[model samples]
Target: MQATGSSHSLALRRGDFTTLIEALDYAAKGDTGVNFYNARGELYATSTYADLQVEVVALARRLLGLGLEPGARVGLVAETSPHFVRFFWACQYAGLVPVPLPATMHIGGHAGYVAQLRGLIENCGAAVAMAPVEWMSFLEEATTGLTLSFVGTPEDFDRLTPSTATLPTVAPDSIAYLQYTSGSTRFPRGVVIDHTTVLANINDMASHGLKMTEQDRFGSWLPFYHDMGLVAFIMMPMATQRSVDFLGTQDFAMRPRKWLEMMSGNRTTITSGPPFGYDLAAMRVRPSDAEQWDLSALRVACVGAEMINPEPLKRFAEALAPSGFKSTAFLPCYGMAECSLGISFAGLDEELQIDYVDAEQMQEDSIATPLDPEEAQKSKRRVARYVDCGALLPTFEIAIRDEHGNDLPERQAGVIHLRGPSVMSHYFQEEAITRECLSEDGWLDTGDIGYLANGRLFVTGRRKDMIIIHGRNIWPEDLEYLAKTQPGVNYTDAAAFSVPSDVDQQETAVLVVQCRERDEIKRARLVKTIASLVRSEFGIDVVVELVPTRTLPRTSSGKLARARARLDYLGRRQAAKMQHQPEPANSLPMDEAMPQVRYIA
Candidate 1:
């Protein structure tokens, strides 16, 4: 991928304002513009503005008749479907705020889904909670005792009356949507972005960052609830008057190849997902499959929303190299929901910049001193590779600040602070929490640690979750990655965290590995192997525990909730000490037998 510098910019039209309603009007003009696809590789639906306008108008009228005021919050719960899209548009057309609720976890079972739904509806203060008919019984139980104005299924959408109330013309600065931060319950934050903010983020990303064209086709299996899925892929195409090919999130999960196939089949020029998604597809896309499909047009393959793993990116590039995929085409970006999606994006066709730093210096001085990978191998606290997240989006400003809120110099690790028009207005009604993050002039404390090098941003890890052992900041992702290398482990199935030891003055880092192996001998071998690997590689002592798979807590976007995992671990330890309850598969125990290692004083 060759870097196409700032020379690329598309002129914005006056009518093509920040409001989504205005964007939809432009998309509604043409027919044959693709909208959605179901499993089995079929294009299930297509809609022009002319067609969607009719449905949105009727739905708007029905919403008004419900006696809810304009801008009342409506909760949306469903997998990617035409109804979800239609209802979303209807909310915008009728001036209702749509808060997208997370769907059920595939592995969390029914209880987990119910708990998630309950939290979202309660947080958003929804006047209506909507889902499909199959989910009605569960929704009823989940939403019990909430002040729900109405609860309906997708079928009820057809029954909406043609709108008679005057459509409310909202300002660009009016609240457009709410994006929830993907974290544990203790750190739940809703990014409240107005229409102007959303529009600016989208336009800047599409025009300058992504370099999107009307001829470019988009494809994704990412859930609509995720920021990348909702704003970048689904909504950006409509905002830019370009067509998108979407695969259902469930379908893609069930059959990962469908994502690659859709890209190959549709000749999709743009698509984005995390490193795991790429790894999944690369693993499933077999030798025989290559001759049957073509992916010559794929352009911007983005990696974000989680810790950027360079290994998977490399493997994906090698696997698809035979099919005309370039390694340089991989765009590694860094963002949070608080910033309305994108903060920094790599250049269009640039190779990912990875900085190898002295790990000991990083922890002791908070400065990432460049180190050779060879030299790092000999030292106990040696090397760590920090992936550059490219440059800040055209309209956003970023700074690195120390604990005292003083700006730091280049290559010095500190909290990544951002101030931009695209940043959220505030956390929803949580002024205290909002004030803690946002400054008086609108800069937000991202709570992430990184540094600037050669005009690029390099993300280290979340400051709150950083593991300190013998004065070294060991990133949990690094430990979790090593744990995953053990057999019988699933993706995102391990949690590496720090726990306060009874005797140690500081925290003792423990790794909880989830595996399907139940045989005691096999489990012991796995645990011992993990411990040996950690000690040999990082020169750190760790407690390794083998638990059942699919037990780690995950946020709405399918990310591991590290903070929640630590709490769960502590609770299990207390219960075990009390001898009051048997340990459940959901919570695992770590070995307290390992001796702590000594560090150079």
Candidate 2:
């Protein structure tokens, strides 16, 4: 199948419409649309914006014919296919809130996937649920104990009769979608986003973050369930009337090269992912492949979702330099689902900037004192680096507050607070959790610890994941980075947190490294080597534990689930306490497994 053309006859728009249906109406007037690439980097499906508009409206009529309420929730298994895109827009036209459930599946972890799906199904109180043909059995299994009006595939939904009733009027205040957080728990919290909120974010992003042009076409392997994927690639492109290309998230993981191939062959100008995605792509790309790929038109490589790592980005640029990839195209951005996707984004076409600061003063006094890299090397004090996440959108109001909620001055590290049009008002059916983060006067406690310098946001660490010992705060990313520097340790292999030890009730920092080595001696040495490095670097003793590869749990969006890992550590210790009782000869080991990674917990 031929993909959509890069240039369209229709005039370009920058997310100026009031609702998604309105935006789709405008985009459908153009020839630009979305293209889906298979695992082999070949285009398999193509849908022009006009075709999408006509098809979804019909699907909307069919859905409304089911006699479901206007505001009924539709649980959709997002698998990066045309079906998901169709169903998502159909719900929008039908005035139904489409909840994109994760299509991610762990190898041989069916039970966990079922539990997660069941929890989400019940959490959102879905009126209807649909899955792809290949995933139908799992969906049936997950919905076994739940009650829903309908549970079937897209074809099944299509088999229904069309309604004679007119579709509901699309409103700006109406719920557009329910975006679920990739939490560490079985039940993920859904962030409620309306038409106004989402459009405001999209407008700001297109005008500022991307600085999109008519020639710009987007490409990504990010899952549809992810904010960056759903908002940036799909919605942003459609809203701006630009064509976009997509490769499955699983396809990219298995063959990261396909993403590059598609981008180069299609001349995609915009794409994004977390740091690990770039690292994975760099690892998989060979020198010969780079020579054959022509990526001269590729631009705007946005990075966020976690701490920015310059090393992998640099490697990716260097490897693809022959293919015409420029390092300055890397735009470091910061955002969350709570903000409708974008909060702050770096300047377009600019190099990703880093700020080096005195780690000691910052950790102790909550002050971000600037320090030169050379001075840091000479001085005995530790140094920390934070990427410049650019300035907040013009529509946002930002503040930095200390632990006691007192306002902090510039460069003072504290909890970042924001009030913006796109900020989510509440979590679906989660009032208490909503109040914990969002305040009364419209300010949202982002739960991210960061400081502002010259109006730009530089995120340090997550407030909830901050490791404190003896009144000193430590960024877990710092410890994890150090552990990853060791030999045989790949990126995302280390998870660091504070835990209570056997000797004392107070918390001590622990770094859990996923070691693939089976030899006890090598494993011990790897553990000890990291332990010594941490002690010398921070002047504090840090416990190091080596677990099997893939032991660390990851969120659905492919982020390391540190929160879940911490719970596993606690559960393992609790199990060890019970194991302290006299045991049999062939009993299993305590340190070998984790909670949902399922043994020690």
Candidate 3:
């Protein structure tokens, strides 16, 4: 299959349309469209915008034949294939709200994945659902007990007779899709983003975030379920009449180098991923491989979806530097699904910026004071490093507020709140949660803790993840950092949180590090070393536990789920006591007293 050209002769638009249907109508005039690639960096499928419009409209007619009501929900298993793209756009033409379910199934976790799918399907109240052949069994099982008008795969839907009825007129206020957040979730809620809200965010992203031009093409391996994948790669490119190359998320995970290959081969100017993607790709790339590729055309390599770790990004840039991957192309951004994906972005053609704050003052007073360079050189232990996520778009109004809801000044770390056209009006059918997260006026409590420094946003951590010990604020990321610094430890291997203490009105800090060492002596040494570092750094004793790798739970989008970790820890602790069995050696302090260190191997 031949991929679409990067440069097209048709006029380009910058996501200025109010509805997705309108945007698609305009883009159908252009030759630029989405291209899909297989695991080996080979193009497998290509659909020009004009062809995509015809396919989706035909699919929409068949979907209308199902006799479902307008504004009905259609569940879709979001595999990174042409089927998913066709179905997503078909819903837009049919005037039905599409909800993209996760395509990933964790190793040896079938029951868990099914339950998660069931919860999402139930929550969304989907009237019809579709999945690819490989994922059909899971979708069938998930919807077994539910009442739905129709359920099938793309092939099955195609067999349905096309309706003679005309397609309904989609309003700007109509819901485009329900993006289920892949953040911390016992059960995830769908973020309801209307056509106007999503398009506004896309406009802000193109006009300000990436400064998209007609010359810019896109490439990504982020899954369709992810906001970055859906909006940035899917919507943004088509809105501007730019072609995009897509590598499946699972395929990219199996062959990380293929992502870099796709970028170089396509001469794509923009791509984005979390820090882990860079880390994985850098680990797999060779200097010789970089020397072979022509990557000078690639400019914006956006990083977001998780906290930006400068070290991994630095390594990625260095590894690909031989291929003309400039360090200035690394763009750190801050966004969430609730806000339609993109709040702030670093300056174009700027190097990644870091703000080293005094860790002590940040913990005690919640202030992000820049550390003195001379003092930092003398004793760097007091510094906390955070990447600058840059300025918010002109559309957003941000405020930093304390626990009491009093707005704080710049440089003061507090809950980050935002109000903008991009912000979602509510969670799907979750009015109680919507009320808790959003105010009556407009502001949405983002549940993130950060500070604005000189108009730039520096995200510290999540508000709910904060631990208070001896009336001093404790950030779990700091404790995790101490563990990550240890040898044989990598990023995403440590989880830190506070457990309820035996003492009155106090909590004990705990750090769980995923250790790979099998030797008893080495494991013990690693735990003790991490525990001692916590003592010296925070003046608080922490119980350090070492567990097997991949034991730490993460959200679907690859963010560490610390709250779930704590719950699992407490559950195991209770189970041990009930079985009348002793806990792991040094799993707890010698006594219930304070300032006592314990190490678990």
> What lDDT would each prediction earn against the true structure?
0.76, 0.87, 0.88
**Any runs in candidate 1 off by more than 4 Å, and if so which?**
1-16, 32-34, 106-108, 185-187, 378-381, 487-491, 503-505, 580-601
TM-score of each: 0.91, 0.96, 0.96
Expressed as tens digits, the lDDT of each residue in 1-601 for candidate 1 is 1111111133333224769888777666654244666678777776654577678777877887787887788888856877777788788888888887776574457887787788878888889878877677777778999888888886775675555768889778878877777767474666787888888888778877788765677788888888888888667777776667778888887888778877887778888888878887888877778667677788889889545878888888878877788888899999878877888888888888888988767777888899989866666456778887899988888889999999999999999999988889899879999899899987899999899998899998888888988877788987887888876675567788888874665678788876666455666677778888878867787866565555567766767788888887776677666975443433323333321111110
- In TM-score terms, candidate 1 sits at 0.91
Prediction-by-prediction clash tally: 4, 0, 0
Ranking by TM-score: 3, 2, 1
What does candidate 3's lDDT look like per residue over 410-521, in tens digits?
A: 9999899999999998999989999998999899999999999999999988877898899999988889988999989988789999888745737999898777766667
User: Is candidate 2 or 3 superior in lDDT?
Assistant: 3
Candidate 2 lDDT over 1-601, as tens digits, reads: 7899999778878999999999999999989999999999889999999999999999999999889998899999999999999999999999999999889876338888887888898999999999999888889999996879899999999999999998999889999999998876446789999999999999999998788888999999999988888888878899999999999999999999999999999999998988899999999989999999988887899999657878888889998998999888998998999999988888877887889899889888988899998878887668888899999888999999988899999999889999999999799999999898888999998878899998889998878788988898888998999988988899889898988766777888888878666565666667677878888878778877666677788888888888888887777567756868532222322354532121110
Q: For model 2, where is the 10-residue window of minimal lDDT?
A: 592-601
Please, what's the RMSD in Å of model 1?
5.4
Model 2 global lDDT (CA atoms, 0 to 1)? 0.87
